[model samples]
Target: MADFTYVSTWRGFVYVAFIIDVFAGYIVGWRVSSSMETTFVLDALEQALWARQPSGTVHHSDKGSQYVSLAYTQRLKEAGLLASTGSTGDSYDNAMAESINGLYKAEVIHRKSWKNRTEVELATLTWVDWYNNRRLLERLGHIPPAEAEKLIMLPSETMIWQPEFTDKTLSRKPGAVQTGFTRHAVSWGVCHPNIYYFHNLTPGWVSFNGEKPEIAIVPQSLHRLIYGPDKRSSPSLDDDLVVNLCTSEHLLVHHPMLEGILLSECERLKQHSLANKLISLFRQFGGTELRLKLVWLCWLDLMTGNSLDDWTKNLKHKSEKDLEQWIIARQGQSEPLTNLMDQYVLMAYRTSVDAAHS
Candidate 1:
């Protein structure tokens, strides 16, 4: 929930906005502004986004003018957040926010009279750090919110995201709206539809799927568009192509043209900054499948096109056609062969994640 409270500073009344995560009772984002405006809340929301990167969370706030403004709502929609407002004119509807405001009033605002917005801002900066990392909350088993969040951090796949709409269960929180979230409890951020679709599919996997006459069109769109498809990839069929079919059912479908198309797409990605996308995929995927990820790394090498140097140092540079014959033989392997191969893929992924963060 987000709301602004006025602090009695010497110059005048300065407003401070708070965006709290109801789960841990953690203040994920906040801003101390000289005036109450939409940007006051928006900047704090952005801070929470940069910090938490949550997906499918609901943001509840009162029907204050700033919260209802177009800019605020549009920003929520852009972040894939669901927006819910408490019924108008009822202070009890946003009881959680009201309680926090009371806490703030007692803790800092009433304790000392700030000389200016600068003093309040600085104090808030110190207070927020303390609140997240140290201050104990009775609701969270008397431990600090940050510590509580650490306890709640479930595995990514098993983490249960909030429902799409508001209901009585959410209302119990009484104004637990989220403009910003803490990543400790929920970490999913929006990924591009195309990247999520194409990142896991190898050319060999696509080839095997393409051999099925009914499924051939799916591979074409996933491959380099230069090869073309009878029907292009769209939202409806992307999930069906990936999840519905069992890998064990397919014979590694081969096409003389597939290797060329995948080469073109891989090289195209490597030439542009989009090649960095594979690194983004690294954090989410458990690890590479079989040696296909290895093949992909080889494909990315401009000097040694399709050479299995890292995985098989014995064989020097290998041509695309030679690599093709080798890949055809290994598609049936159920599991990745060596732990060393997984380490290599994981090492590359970690480097990517670290570089991007730095």
Candidate 2:
């Protein structure tokens, strides 16, 4: 909330506008001017913007002509601030700002007589510095606003470990195929028993009805455009074609694409709520690029025909038991594999909860 009060002196009356943070009661921005122009409020707001570089901040003020003017409203919008007005003649609406105004009047204006506006301005500069950095208020636990801010902005501690679901409950079996497609399905609960539309289809998974008819995996729009007139039969249904369905469908759906398919895929994956946890984990471990890298890795894994047995062949210990042990050992470790593992674990927990409710 913000408000400006007048300082009377022998020279003239100086209007001082202040933008106060409601929560901390800190004077974030202030501007002293000779007249009460719309710029009077805008200058203070500008100062606050430069100091905080805030986004989605609310600037609440009274319905003064200065605040309601087009220039002032435009400035607020440009700075990404939400401009709010209190009801006219209602003290309670702007009580926080009013309270600060009252304190300023009592502490500065009434304390001593000033010769000119210059003296009042100078005195205000000194007083504001002391108020924000040195003044201790009972409301702030007798600590200065600067100190309170430091405490509030400090980083929080890391999360402690907690296991919410077991392997059996999540329907994850020991030594089961741990392909990229399976990981994605388990993590997101996207591969349902009924609704089997996939962003990417892999080995050993059938369509919803299991008819296995030749499916033309095209964009819904293209399907409409082609069949609306031709009434043509879908193209030959083959495993290779079915395997490419997801990526092909994505390209068809997002027609007239200007950029790479990988970017689109990455964005689409992130939109899923379950995928968010995986994205966050990647961000924490690796930098920003890791999020996109992990997505591409999943795509690459999906493209590969290699089975777990094949992958385990050249390992230091090559037995089936050795491969399973190695897989378990690497759980929650690093990128790509770690994200995939986390996804499966989460999916298992979700499945258990859904089953219980159903």
Candidate 3:
């Protein structure tokens, strides 16, 4: 959903409009203006349209006058986009957009002072670049939004976070980011044994998460670790075969056999600063083996129920336009967003399990 927030500057108050791609939480389009005119929202929409060239994309927003204007509606219709507005007095209806607005406020507007529209615009441009390209998001598996979209299934140079075994464990390297855990998360580029297994099995390279060319661990390996090496067709290896994190040293060490641990951890620790860091390292095992494609499905389901058909079966190849319609339908639903998100994750887990077995 799209919404504009007011920014205070020496020149006056400028409004900022943002159109976010709910899939990876990327701000696809944005505009900063001194006025809350329809043109402001329209310009943002035009930029998004031009960048994505999307057809049947849903544009959801609050019942603001600018969003409901004739000019905006006409533009959406002409571009083959659908417009959806929340009901009166319902903040949760446009919760996702509002959440973005809240983040922009906390991270940029509230933290820094602005001189004029030019300054705000420049800052926003920089922030968007950082947010999409470098910022690690827990929802997207501790990867940036752009990296999620440009996913290389078999990454040539993949970085793994080697967890410190205990507080007494000597540091092999300096920590990149402080995650407030007992053990500081360290990133390493060395080839782990799991990488070699995939390299040998698939040969050249394959999409572990179905995002071609990017190296990611498929559910089969996760199954081997979570269940047992002999549980599947793969040859039995030591306990360290997969990036097993559920040992006595980690937070989730007790819940080794947990299903949907990734999604559950998200709901459990959504507000924790160190949540993403912990999750990215821990989700490699159990039934919650995280992947970008499955996370994208959770995003779609979070936005709206039944927006995309369950890919566990026949309708696995739905188009983008159909996905957009699902978002529009979701905005109009009376059901809770959390329930929908859970349902989608469940469906994704089942589908992934089936795919791994096949």
Q: Write the per-residue lDDT of candidate 1 for residues 62-119, one digit (tens) a residue.
A: 7788887888888887886656665577554455667777888887778877899999
Candidate 3, run of 10 with poorest lDDT: 182-191
Output the worst ten-in-a-row residue range by lDDT, candidate 2.
Answer: 157-166
lDDT for residue 203 in candidate 1, whole number 0-100: 22
Q: Identify the runs in model 1 with alpha carbons over 4 angstroms from their true place.
A: 154-358
Task: Give me the runs in candidate 3 sitting further than 4 Å from their true place.
Answer: 152-358
Tens-digit lDDT track of model 2 for 96-200: 678778888888989988888778888888888988899896656788878766654543221111112223322221111122332322222222222122122
Of candidate 1, the 10-residue stretch with the lowest lDDT total is 247-256
lDDT of 3 by residue, 1-358 (tens): 5788999999899999998865556788999998888999999988888877765445667778887787887787788665666656666556667777887888888987789999999989888888878988775579897886564222422322222222221122111111111111001101112222211110011121233232112223222322333333222222222221211222322221122233323333232332343344233322332332344333333222332224333223434455445444643453443343344344333212111121
**What do the candidate models score in CA lDDT, each in turn?**
0.48, 0.49, 0.49
> C-alpha displacement of 12 in model 3, angstroms?
1.7
Residue 71 of model 1 has an lDDT of 89
